[model samples]
Target: MGRLKVRLILAFLSLILLPIGVTGSLLQLQSSELEEKERSYRDSMNELESTIKRELTQTSVSDLELNALVNQYAAEINIKDAEGETVFTSYKDPEAAPHNEAIVDSSTLFHVQAEDGRILFVELSSQLPFTDTILRSILISVGSGLIALILLIIGWTWYISRTILSPLKEIYAATEEVKEGNLDYPIQYRRKDEIGKFIRGFNTMRTHLKQSQEKEEQFKEDRKQLIANISHDLRTPLSSIKGYVEGLQDGVAQTDEMQEKYFRVIRQKTDQLDHLIEDLFQFSKLDLRQLPLDQQFVDSRVFFQSLLDDAVEDGKSKNVCIDVPRQIPSVTLSLDPVRITQVMNNLTENAVRYGADSIVISTRIDHDESNFTISVKDNGEGMEKEELTKIFSRFYRAEKSRSRESGGTGLGLAIVKSIIEQHGGSLWADSELNYGSTITFTLPFLKKELV
Candidate 1:
């Protein structure tokens, strides 16, 4: 389809070219009509002159008879004798001659002999059919037509400006508003054309920019909250370590027994601080998308076996019993082993800390074999529906008091979610209060496509 510019050009060009062409044609028609009229007048004048000659030569008529004969045939007639005396005249008012010699004078003067050898002068006065009055009328008609064409062009140009240029002006105004940070302003034009599509695109861009600004603002607010939470969480362990160190230095733990206990407490607090700082580092890397993934296809059976074995060893002292299918399917998958290991370790440790005796890790292939679903379940004091929804949010804990006491940094599940997303997968949790909680994530399996 042609664009609006091309269409408008064609419209204006036709208006200009067609009118000029028609006017030229009309001018030619008028000239041809005038030429035909002049030719007919010349023919009539020639016939009159021939008749005057034949009658005076062939007929035995006197000058008066010849004058009467010529007057009877012609519209305007005059005759003179050999001595240049007027013998006959046709005009009632002789001074009021009808001839306009400048335009197309047909008046002629010729001599003829009478039957008795008398010389006579024959004068015929006539005019062509196309006179100054008729020429002026044709010129006036052409002028009127030209005026009408010019008015039409002007009116069409006005209409085109209203239809096309006006909308463009509005679009430019909208852009100016946008430039001044007025994204809320709207373009009101609504047509099913290129201009309309442009307006819609502008509206969409405005909406996206507004949303982006809102997200950036929200991110700033979230950052503030994160800093506050991290500071408070860090101060707890630091304060405990400081207090125990002071006790040691001030001889509050004078005996070997007290000193040992104080040292142990200080070490535990130090470990908590270390874990919290590490989590903060990891969260920052993931948030910035700076963490690299070393993805590769590996046998699922071997990968899950090693992962579960390590989890079991770590949770052995905590009475954390974990289970996995012994005959796990040897399906091949593309994944980042290090990241997935981090995910499972975090989930397993969370379960062990939350007083879960048993943890189950299982996997299944989708019916279409397009994806593999991995689920980790624990029979712990599960969360409510509302808590489950926010379980993956940074620093969101199901039980804040218990989390603080248990030295939970509240970033494990959040990190888990980030890793899963980085691997192009989705993660969610399902749970019922007092029953159990299960976290499931899906990883797609690719197959070669037909080219």
Candidate 2:
């Protein structure tokens, strides 16, 4: 299974099995050595019996003297005559049997038939030295095995703790760094295991958190720029209104026609102020996702034709000839027509203000089955590539100057982008510095598959 599972399994198995195996091995060694000692002791007893029988039959030695010879074997001697009379005993207590003492395991009984037709009984008993030696060997072997097992347990514990603790320590350190807001630091573990996967997930989380923080900062910056632009833009129109009002009060317009003309200019400036305020409010609503779409089904051909006809009239009236596509593909679209119209109006207004003598509205079907692309192209002073990237950003102007020629409150393109994106479409601009600019956007069709 996993590395952690395997390590734990092995550790527990060793804990259960190692001591049992060591104990069994030492017990078997002790038993084998004891058996060998028993065999040697039995052989020595047989040899001593043969020597005693031969000495009593051939040498005719008395039991007391024979007992003196038994001392050489470190054995106790007991003798009895055929008449059942006690003859001699090497034991300190004449009535005591050697087998009744601690040397019972070493006691051996022998019967001898002498040539004089007499029967004799002899008992020999001694503590075997090999028994004590074997006992000591067993104790030492058991103690050594227990010590070896303890060391093995200690070593195993160290290995298991290191294997588990090291990774845990690394993870803990990484989390502490994240808590301190250092998301840029990365862990360098690359094992293909659970811990590795966990580390990778943590790294991914850190990256996303860092990105979210950056977006928040950028949002704050955009809000600040919006406030600054609004103040500057409102100052211009309010200044004009103040100047015109003061001029009228001071009788600068003496004639009725002049007075009427001054009032008309004031009205025009007031209208401009109203439109600026409305656009700013709309952009804010769109940015905050407060504006919801009221989508309608409209024939693409009719929609484009009507929109183009209005643009052509406005463009011609202003001495700028705008071109409309003669043919538009017959496709039904699901869209918010009011918002799309506002986007086109903003783009067309930009074209006219920026010295475009000719403008064209065109369409292209996207490779996808659901959506079609529309572009507003103008032969205006196009922007640099770097400027193109920031054109759709709120309060960003490539010209870097607040002027009437640059059009509305600098939120027009940004609003257009938000509107198109809200409708599940995309918007972008293509421009060459000296050639021209095209603002393109996608509109989805009414097909159910498109949704």
| Candidate 2 lDDT by residue in tens digits, 182-268 | 878777777667777888898899899989988899889988987887787778778988998999999999999999988998898
lDDT of 1 by residue, 201-252 (tens): 9889999998998889867876886787687888898899889998988989
- Residue 169 error, candidate 1, Å: 3.5
Candidate 1, which segments miss by more than 4 Å at Cα? 1-5, 21-164, 184-215, 247-264, 325-327, 351-358, 367-369, 379-402, 408-410, 431-436, 446-451
Report clashes for each candidate as comma-separated counts: 0, 0
- Residue 300 displacement (Å), model 2: 1.9
Point to the candidate with the largest TM-score.
Answer: 2
TM-score of each: 0.64, 0.66
Task: Please list the residue runs of candidate 2 whose C-alpha ends up more than 4 Å from where it truly belongs after superposition.
Answer: 1-7, 14-164, 186-205, 402-407, 446-451
The whole-model lDDT of each prediction reads 0.78, 0.77
Q: Lowest summed lDDT over 10 consecutive residues: which window, candidate 2? A: 95-104
Give me the displacement of residue 34 in model 2, in angstroms.
Answer: 14
